[model samples]
Target: MSSKFKKRLKQLHGSREKRRRQSTQDEQSRVFTADDVEEQDLGIATSAVDAWRDHGADSRPTARGEAHFLVRHHPQSHQHGTKRLAEGAAVTLEGFRKQLNDARLHSADPSRLVFLDLETNGLSKTSFPFCIGIGVWEGSQFGVYHYFTPTEADEPASLSACAEILRDCEGLCTFNGSSFDVRMLQRRFSHYGIEHPLDDLAHLDLLHLARKLLPDRNGHKLSQLEEDVLGFGRTDDVPGAKIPGRWKQYLKTGSPHLLLDVFDHNRLDILSMVVLLPALAEGLGSSSDSARFKNRASKSDLGNRPSSSGSDQQARPPKAKPKTKLASQLSRTYALRKKAQSGGRRQPETRPTEQARQEDVPRETVKLAGSFSRAKLRRGMPIGTRLRELRGEVERLEREGRGDEERDEIVHRLHEMVALSPRNPFALERLVDYYRGTGDAALADHFAKRLDETSPF
Candidate 1:
């Protein structure tokens, strides 16, 4: 007989109806219900034009009779960056072919490649992609075109718009489109009975290559690389996990205001890949190229950036920054904050993760984190415990005549080790011998000084 008991009983089976609809159209007019909102067949016929009418100015129907919602960076006014993006894109295609182990991808021309990203409701048959972002070379410039679905009825239109534009391109590129985005599109197309043109197109999913290239990055999420390695972070951006909810909010309220955040989020994801792809491809070509890429990413030379988040921030993940011993970088981060505070603007809050990124040491740390550094090889082995292990990697390279860049990077690691354990003498003597062989008596003397400092003899 209690009201609380009755409410609990009402929610148990979702037997209570949320909304009622009168049919000027076929839509159920029902809002989200406990059982109805699950990603399954809603039994609503999405293909018919009679189901939905314009709710207001913000919600309208596209010419194709699909729901239309978020569109941004319209290619008409969007400009191409000054960098030779065509060359960069082509090189990126080659890198993809190398990593994906697929010869079929060669059919994709670098001159006509397209970058693709999608925001979807969920991964169920009824779940749909609400927004699609595609970046293509337009005339002399690279432009990004956005296609969005306004309602469940609009999903097909968004995909149709996307397919029509992409039909002309030689291939497609995505962050991790291989496993999720592309596959989802293909499935939806199959369900809709439309021919999926992308089926035969070449795809270069950067996610897989990112794993091979940035093993030090841990989980390999796009956001992590967006800050630490790419040196471009977002401000006031929506966390990716919340993206689906943003779309659902618009769906229920018919307000397009917050969708702008999704537009910005999609825009940045596309542009970052455009900028980052070439820098990464160039590294795959050679060791020197890798060194140069490290320098560019570390510096501000790779300039395409996203809006960074504001003062309300959380602690950044550990190992996000490169393991360098520079104290000056930390000092500079504080100086920038003090400057901001004095200017009357809210000072950007610094998290522990921000320190290394604020240091912005450069791409060499990214490259080092991957395969060519002593950091991964040096985990937890002390100078006393693993002098052999300490010298194992660099010694192999030296004996094989294989390490040109490896030698330069290893010497820094050796210096750190010798600093930590001068008494061991093994690392110090090797440094002296290595520096002397390389004809740097000044450097050799530096290690010898440590040796002398550590021992009386």
Candidate 2:
């Protein structure tokens, strides 16, 4: 027998013994019937409890059992990065309702509206949440609370604690909670056989609302909005993917150190929602109300803005920055990166004449890539060739299951095709379908009307 074969046999024998021991333990611990009122309190080691306490979390008794959580109260004068959590207190209820498009929020008390964010082990139904971060308005200050699950067994206690806080709130605000957090919590509550407290609350999902109202943002992610809209940025924050592993590590090693960053990440997410609500409401407010909010925001933001020689234009609305140069650079980079990422796709070859023609077109005169200007339209690029190329690109993108990722590019090309050939029913029909699918009734109706106008009965 070879040495390698002998070692492999020993490893397999050891694993078999381990499994046998686990099965025996399971059999011995099995219970025949469930008892609802009886609590199986598994006490964590004193060292582990002390470690978590050192990081600001303390063990508290909930209706279900003992849960570990942290609570911090921020004074009204305290600012989170560049924006004050107090600014959210200034949000008009009507404007906020308009921003989220939920009438129920119009009558809801602002102080009772809670910002919720969760840290979970994974996205699957089988996955468990380890932390729940909540923000609530208390008197004249804001409060941030985090409920922690020490183990999978502690989930019931943590959820109970979270529900107790949520019970007092009339409205819930979350970044992308509609698709993930809310569903996750519902599943968890169902799993634990507990009544859900969030069912009757006015849910304001900021993700979809942000995309609709702030279309010019680079991205609508909580972190992105925190930087772009709230003017707040995090340093040394933990990536969400690694959070599950941190919990597992703590479970194995009995060390709570890895979880410190996880708590910070959750805390920042809740705090950002505190400011993002008012910022988004400012855009969705009526004209006069919007102007008032903007003026207040601008005044508060004066410290971060560059000092102007003349203060006369202090109240003037910020002007849109030119995007000609940025658009050109982004277009080129996108093409190159797309080709690189799609390993099978080869770069298209261009003729010297075509290159020279592109160079001769002045940068200042260049329009957004897909949308053409009249000056560029005058140049003799064959309409048929461009249309064929665009159709081919769309087909390729759809074939590769990237239709959703590149839908905007596809729509832009379809519009260009229609522009070049006004009677092109195919492009016009596609435009109508695309808009309708995306829930844009106005654009869909306009395109449908155009499709009918171009059709020959």
Each candidate: RMSD to true structure? 20.8, 17.3
Which 10 residues in a row give candidate 1 its minimum summed lDDT?
48-57
Query: What C-alpha lDDT values do all the predictions have?
Result: 0.62, 0.73
Candidate 2: pairs in clash: none
Instruction: Give one digit per residue, the lDDT tens place, for model 2 in 208-287.
Output: 87777655434567776665567777889998889988888888986777887888898888888877877877776678
lDDT assessment of candidate 1: 0.62
Q: What is the TM-score of each candidate against the true structure?
A: 0.50, 0.57
Residue range 111-158, candidate 1, lDDT tens digits:
587889888887776777877878887665666666665456667777
> Which structure among the candidates has the greatest lDDT?
2
Instruction: Show model 1 residue runs off by greater than 4 Å.
Output: 1-92, 291-457
- Counting clashing residue pairs in each candidate, in order, gives 12, 0
